[model samples]
Target chain A: MTTHNKIDPLGPGYEGVAGKELRFRDVFRDTLRAEMNRDQDVFLMGEDISGGFDRDTKEPLDAWGGPFAATKGLVQEFGPERIRDAPISEAGFVGAAVGAALTGLRPVVDLMYFDFVTVAYDQLLSNAAKSRYMFGGQTRVPMTLFARSGAGTGHAAQHSESFYSMLAHIPGLKVVVPSDPYSVKGLLAAAIRDDDPVFLVNDKKLINLTGFVPDEDYVIELGKGRYMQRGDDVTLVGMSYTSVVCEQAAVQLADAGINAEVIDMMSLSPFDEDILLESVQKTNNVVIVDEDTPRASMASEFAAVIADKAFDHLDAPVKRVTGPHSPVPYNKGLENAFMPQPEDVVGTVRNMLGRD
Target chain B: MEISKEKLEWMYTTMYRIRRFEETMLEQTFKGNSMGVTHPSDGQEAPPTGVCAHLTDKDWIGSTHRGHGHCIAKGLDTHAMMAEIMGRATGQCGGKGGSMHIADFSKGMLGANAIVGASIPLAVGAALTAKYKGIENESVGVSFFGDGASSQGVLHESMNLASVWKLPVIFACENNGYAEATPAWYSVSAEDIASRADGYGMPGVVVDGMDVFEVYEAAGEAIARARAGEGPTFLELKTYRYHGHFHADDPKKYRKPDEEEHYHERDALKNFEKRVTGQKLMSAKKLKSIRDSIEQEMLDAVEFALESPMPDVEALYSDVYVNYSNPIFGLR
Candidate 1:
């Protein structure tokens, strides 16, 4: 039940009211508050989300506000009925969210860590994803499963890993991975309003990262890609946290006199194949940067799509800069090596260009 | 809690409807007239009928794989259920769900889950939705599962949630004496499955599943408590399944030779018939007419299912999502 009296202003990315720079987490909380206020049907449920449970009193106190504080001050605004604090039961609560969505409510459920999805895999895949099709279109599960992903936080094997690719493989799901505060606000709003099941994978590393966002509610359409920077030398496709890495890599490429085009693939399932193909046709050389492991990754899918549709337009073989095919290490040094960095993307793009 | 003549009559008819529907499906599957697998609730009608009789379209119920009885009790159209089992486009789920996944959201039957204990959480969610909406609606969510589901962690989790939140839900445990081929005595360590509810801070009651009146009374009390915002109640209906786990299964391989006969003597339908007649709540002639009508209704359902057309190829991709083209490569 903690409260911040100071009014935080908009961040730097967007052209909006001049105010304080908002972090990705603050933007997410604000977006959720706006959505909850806009639609009475919208509600949230997850472990420690309400931050009501007090360890000392053994009674619900007004604050723990979720593990990451993404839902801070929400219980006070919406009350406990709308801002539910669920027990540590992933399968139970996730299944309940699907059922609730199917009936009449638009629920936003938290998976805590993206890796915890394995525990509720059946509910997400079988019940939530397949229910509409299996039931012959009789119902729709309008729910958003939100979770924090990426390996940089050093949460170790169980907590780390970006498995949005696995969820994207399912037919009925819409997967969104936003890299910054602006995209997080817009994409999360869109997911909440979607009539189908949407997975909003927030990068754990980007929680404290600051960016400019609007003060009002807005939606960025799912499956659309945006160009962070454009050039004809080569196209660098990055998703989620890796998009930030690509921005850095593009800077390094620019320093070496290599004009590179950077494309952020924010949505993975209803991915912008047209944008990828058009970019590859223009640049002829492409390097895909992914935070997930390389094998059967979204990068692999994009590479295949490129080879299949834009093979004749290629100047050189497509390259993939991704995490290695191994578990995310717990040690900071090993974990850093386990994940892809800007230098890896820079070197991959330079090598693709046949430059030392 | 006084049982009226009309309510008793409806209960008898509801039980008869479930029995006839399941029996017809069983016979059809044996004759190769039905598509996919079927889990018949031939001898287990009282629990669903009694429990669902207390519910309405505003209330929701989650069912198990052996769910035809629950669907009927929950007020789903017999023709749609039959068509669904037969994989016809006219079915409730448009032929996609088949037997194991039959659902009619319009009637608040939240579909039947093949995975044991899966629907418990779903019912809890529905109850949470009702609670969130406020108590003026008095809406309750009912979840029906087998004894096998008692072992699932979800059941405990859901119960704890329902209890803690005081959400309006009824955890109906239909202990049909077995979890598929394994006997409940072997799988469930507790002497009574109802006792497990004590751990979750809720009322635990066991009802005679063979007697419809007993189930009706117990379910009524639980439903009342839920509607009054007293939280969830766990009702363990001591029942039995006359047939195998599914139509294709052979019960003899796993059960005693006389087990079916032993349970059949106090069968739900038979006991209901005897009690209603003895109490003069309904005459034998009236019960006969009700039974005959249900029989004809089932016959018509089977015919409708047989005559209905299979779903079109275009429907293969429909209903996967409200919008957005599936982007999985090669799936299209």
Candidate 2:
């Protein structure tokens, strides 16, 4: 593989222009590069991250850039010292990231797939999440655990899963699920700089999704939700890539004479309850779209929140459109059916509105 | 490799302090002064004392559940540790982490892990940091785990990673015979835990953990190699835990009645005292004075812990994140 020339995306010519859009992966790569350049303490470590290791020569022939090329060309610029590749040892590397975080360097550990996190859950939960609190506020684990979540890429159950809910259930962890390129670039930069352990779940389905991303460094504050579109008839809450589906569903609902408010729930753990409650209070009709399975999902939690706090103001019951409670099927048709589609969101919202 | 009289005295005093601290903790637990369970490192003090002797505050060390010995040897304030065990706010972990999770980052003790072999990778990560920052091999990361933790897959992974990366790390396994109730003989497939290090392309040395000098000699070589950018080493120290796994455990059910007495005869503290005094390295009067001072120090720690107040109820919601507010359910 030939090395690609590094382009200064943040150079004078490229500011926040409407047509100057970047793919989700490019946005992520640019954000990481900017962070590494900004802070000497930041580094990346994972399996085959700085790829193409020639065993005979004992040298790297090429950098695969990461499984999805989210870290492409970084090794050539930063060199192997900053972009390290590890054996297929999740616990060893992720735990090492936690250890490194405690000692000063901010490490961004890549969990190739969110499903593979189970292999290294103890390190993330027992060590990374608990270290700060267990150490009596004397310590901080400023590590970013980056992983690809959601299904639709045909990688099967082991490779495709949106388990951000499980991580969001954890208390000392900040879970960020940016829906588009713009949000991902800013949210990732925020996570890397944050003084706590942040789990950045990039949706696999949104890897190629493109949008206008600012060339300059920016950070979207954690626990804050953004509105993609404003309306009043019904409130639609979507997380990660599902926010696109929510936006599409809102457009469909608008054509059918139903005004829908689309709110992108960017951060999950310290969830923006105020914005959600305000939206629910305004619309009184709500539908939560999430890719995770039904039970114990972020969608379910939002439904519970509406029922508990805004129950009296509800026009109807809070509706939830989530993936089925089962492993993501390998077959194309079954996998498509398992994931929450825009039609599912439209149908759920329509049913809640008594228009079905 | 000849240890000076002053260094030997320091080692002896630290080991004795650990012994007395564990003993006092056991007594306090029985008296209901200390809360939660404690896995005392009663007879297994030499491994941490020796390995940590070669390390400074710049170097990092990850520990296991039986970590009081490691913490004490790494220069943690005995008063803070005692307070922590008693659940006082003045404790090392602000009373949040009782005995098992005591950590003082200021001293480079990366907290004791309750999970087996969990901290091995952490030490490797710290070493990775030291390497990344180009510390010129001045700092190293040391991970101390029991023989039981050696069976964990992370241990082998860590060994291999440390070797391949040439990370400045030392994997110290204190083979204390038993992993809770199960014997290492039944659990471990290998005859010696350190021997497994050879499979990962690193030096594996076994030492008599009951002898501090032997441990110090072996550890000094390994630590020096690590600081010189020579990669990692897996050192297994053969030791014994005289007490049960935890405060409430009964070792009588698992082991033979004579086993405890056999280990007691070769207790690390007693054996070291005998060897040092017998060789005229230090007089018995000097040793007694050291013991007396440590005894009083432990007493003062206990008193401080008892007098300290419990953490405020408001502290529960704090420290979960550096900036974000973690509102407890039903409380807000």
Candidate 3:
């Protein structure tokens, strides 16, 4: 957020941009397929991507069709060589992805779960993230890694995580969280084409949800955020599934005459500071929402940005509605309580506006 | 394993280059010219020289912390490497990577990774690229790591991935008997690191790392097997490191003089000279000439490093990303 570098937010050419309704997972798959078709060098690597092989035929069985079926039927189109199924070796494959990228290939890795990122953390941190800078630009790791994140599916603790800040904290890595189908399509496309290492976190909740996506080939610029809804009273900031929550809260707040603007932070690292500053300057009141734990989360980071850059512009102290600083619980009620809900955002806005 | 005159000269020169580079680099580190910790690979030259001799700029290699030998064998510029060790602007990685992270992409040297077992997958990844491109014959991968890294989980993971996919990769484990003062016998689980290859379903070979000819022949077959799309090969090079782990470390504390004397008695360079001269493959004068030329190259490299300018302050913000809008984070 401290980075002053600003992008135009890439809102151009969308005027009358023809579209189609599609689910988030479909868009995710389509983007991968498009990138693969666009570049021969592009390939996929992950465990169970092409789930298993028929012992007799030796042909790949696209069993799981990738995590959450995000990359279903890709192997059939591209074959097992291009849509590769790796062993459950995160560190090993990720490091190999780094090498592949360094040499001359675009490797898109499906890490399955964001929580499992720790297993391959060293490869991502030491090799992927630091390669370009450490090697003095001798090589570019043009690799895209995506996985399922967020904690709503009764996946309990280990399977669910929405830690965008953890990836963003690193210098060389780009982090993007697509809120819905359209954003996932655009951001995932942008991430795949990006020359640097990018991690696009897909929330399991958003995977099934459908949204309007333009049929034309397009990519949202990296480090750009878009205003999903524009209003005047307060700025409601969210990333990934939390953006959906923000939109829901915005609708409820409007009923109460609290015109809240919604900012879907598509990209976390090199995030759109201009949009945040412009919205905060207009509203003079802001509330950030994140599914990640409170301490050192993206919610806290956005709040800090507003505090440091627009201290006098703020009518009230920036509020952060985030998950409590604890592990994601298993129980339904506790799990629901763990993340920032639409009610939480609505309530925070009501209290900030003194409507309560 | 047929040694032509040109190949023989290259083998000797590459080994000498590595041995001298490490020695000179250590002397410079002791002289306070080098910026940080340097792991000298003085006694371990034959493995990289032999393996990389079969490689070109088209092929790729992933090296370890003790990686000067690999860099030299891979044909990286001695001047740039020396400058890198000294933290100069003209260094291989513009002084950013320093001693443990020197890399030359054009030379197909992935990097000398500071983290143990980290580079193993990188080499596999490179092999994957070759396989995916259907150019396995033109480009293969070699991972040169230590016995310490042999215990790393990623190594096993890489072996499995390579074997299963039949990727063109060679797992070159330089068993120099020590992983930072701890003996490999005490740390490595198996009697031989190469034996682990059997579990992964690959051909494993143990070679005398001190003998350049033995290493050259063993690596040639492995490289050929890989190029033929016959999957991966594991070569456990039984070698030794003459110097301590780092520039500042003292081997005398943890190692006995007898062990040191034993390796020196079977010195790779001395043995190569005797064998080559005795067999009349190379004259003693020719060997001396190669030594003299390498010694001069070492001196030149040192001078180039010492005289090279330091990196500019602006370098702190460069190369983090290809097109990051604002890499430097600050209050607007």
Candidate 4:
């Protein structure tokens, strides 16, 4: 019930910014520093985030050093009290963030790896997600659990996963998958300020990808889907790191005389189904590309919805490009083959066109 | 012996409230008046009442599925809780989270989770917040879970974190001998759930859960240690549940016929009654009067819920998400 008249960091001031202009890594770093600067209630808790902070010596060290490197240089600006290096215990820190959130502190906990979310599922799903509603809305858990997702690095099956669909299935969770640098900056800012528990997902591949971003603060509202590209031949839905794959496929389709409208679903739980359906109805063709397994994947769910709602408007059956329902292989070749690539999208589109 | 007559009476009354509430819930369960499932706190009221006796509103509590005792001990209104059980609009959770998930954050009772050991980290987190905010002595967190939750990895991690940070927290393990239908030995691998706390470098204590004084004394030391910034304490309360695993369950398949009778001998209710009456704290008539009033109150709650209409069908989608127009997900 509280309102602040101040413009949010990801406000309209920074909309329509591109990822290639500002590197995704810098956008994340800038967003963190900005949020910390603005809100004293905001703090960071993760493993060794002090990666790029200058100690007493002239040498600069990473302030909040960790595997993801997303939370670097946070400790120097905010001190060790605000930036904590947790023990090798995800459950402990995740739970601590939940408790801290309850007591009026906006804690942004870095999971480092998306697969590690299972270790702290109790804290994430049961404690944090249900605390507000279970306590009859007497508490507000304004915390963010950010982690690096996707299988680009050879971290094998355990580390990389597109588990957003599972997280989205649970109520009381706001799942955000920022595809590019601009979205990452805006979404991270929004997640920090959001009064609810937000899972701000960052793709490892996109971290290096640069995009244009304004110097000021802004917030991209949760549950609002961004139309990355507007077209009429097919409606393409992508979430998490797979949006890059969809963008590439859309380009390939464009060259093949097919204009594909691409929608990047930013948040998953309070999903942008309206925009999804609208785009699908206009294009009359839907292709959902997801990095996760196809079974019960976001793709299958979206396909079902499209099939049910806009079955009449369809030119061909809705196609889903996703990873096989198997463990992510350690082998690079197998992993590449297992994952949904741009070629898969091209092949699916070509097949659909041939059927027409 | 240092306990006052009024305090003893108050503790007894709170115990009576929990016992009567569970009995009434059991009766309704047989009659199919409740939905979902309920893990009743029929016999284990003393741990919550006694442990809570030493705690103020600033201290936090995270409880288990059989969490009615914890909620009542932490000062949650019985009417709202019952309404929540009945799935009413006026429920504490707005009827979204029912019996196993009843909570009131204003009282610092974070919540009771259905998942085992889930509340451990939450309690640690709350304690960490209290420490981080420099609220030190005024606040502490108590996590109450059954013997079953001790096996959960989060419980150990939470203890380790609380100990390392010297966070003001008490891990109150209510070892009621059984985790659901399985015996404690079958589920728990360690000799005692408390013994496991040594690995985390925290003081661990074992006490008679049925004895209010025992639980109170143990919880007192733990709370004091936390307030003094000595870190966390692990308390294994050796208690027993009077009823089945839940209202919908029948312990007859898992329990011996005389088991209830044997446990009733050390019943928390009987023990409290004896302690107070032996000391001539209050007249038997006055105690009976208090019990009668509580019974009437529980009966009134049932009547109110029965007479009350089910939530409006249109209200199903309400309170799902805040500050957003809730989408009708077609789930009734």
DockQ of 2: 0.82
- TM per prediction: 0.95, 0.96, 0.97, 0.90
Q: On residues B134-225, what C-alpha lDDT tens digit does candidate 3 reach at each position?
A: 99999999999989999899999999999999999999999999999899889988998899899999989999998888999999999999
lDDT, each prediction: 0.87, 0.88, 0.89, 0.81
For model 3, residues A277-330, the per-residue Cα lDDT tens digits are 999999999999999988888888888888999999998999999888888899
The prediction achieving the highest TM-score against the true structure is 3
Cα DockQ of the candidate 3 complex: 0.86
Over A1-356, each residue of candidate 4 has an lDDT whose tens digit, in order, gives 11212223232233553324677887888788888888888888877666443556734366335665666666667777777777779987898889888876899988888898998887888878877766566677899988888886787899888777878877777888988876777688878888889998777878888766665466777777777788888877888777889889989888888888888887776777777788888988888899888888778878887888788989899999999998788898988987889988878888877832
Candidate 2 per-residue lDDT, tens place, B170-282, comes to 99999999999999999999899888888899999999998888999999999999989899988999999989999999899898978888888888888888988999999
DockQ top scorer: 3
Q: Which ranges in model 4 have alpha carbons more than 4 Å from their true place?
A: A1-20, A51-64, A132-139, A250-258, A354-356, B248-262, B324-326
Better of 2 and 4 by TM-score: 2
Mark the regions of model 1 whose C-alpha exceeds 4 Å error after superposition.
A1-20, A52-60, B325-332
Worst 10 residues of 4 chain B by lDDT: B317-326
Question: Where does the lowest 10-residue lDDT sum fall in candidate 2 chain A?
Answer: A1-10
Candidate 4 lDDT over residue span B226-320, tens digit each? 99989999999998888888886778889897987888998988877776788787778888999999988998888876666666665555544
Tens digits of per-residue lDDT, candidate 2, A111-172, equal 88998889988999999998999889989999998898878889988888997789998888
TM-score of predicted structure 3: 0.97
lDDT of 1 by residue, B9-108 (tens): 8898898998888889989888887898999997888899889888888899999999999998988899999999888999989999999998988899
C-alpha lDDT of residue B68 in model 3: 86
Cα deviation of B306, candidate 3, in Å: 1.4
- The candidate with the higher DockQ, 3 or 4, is 3
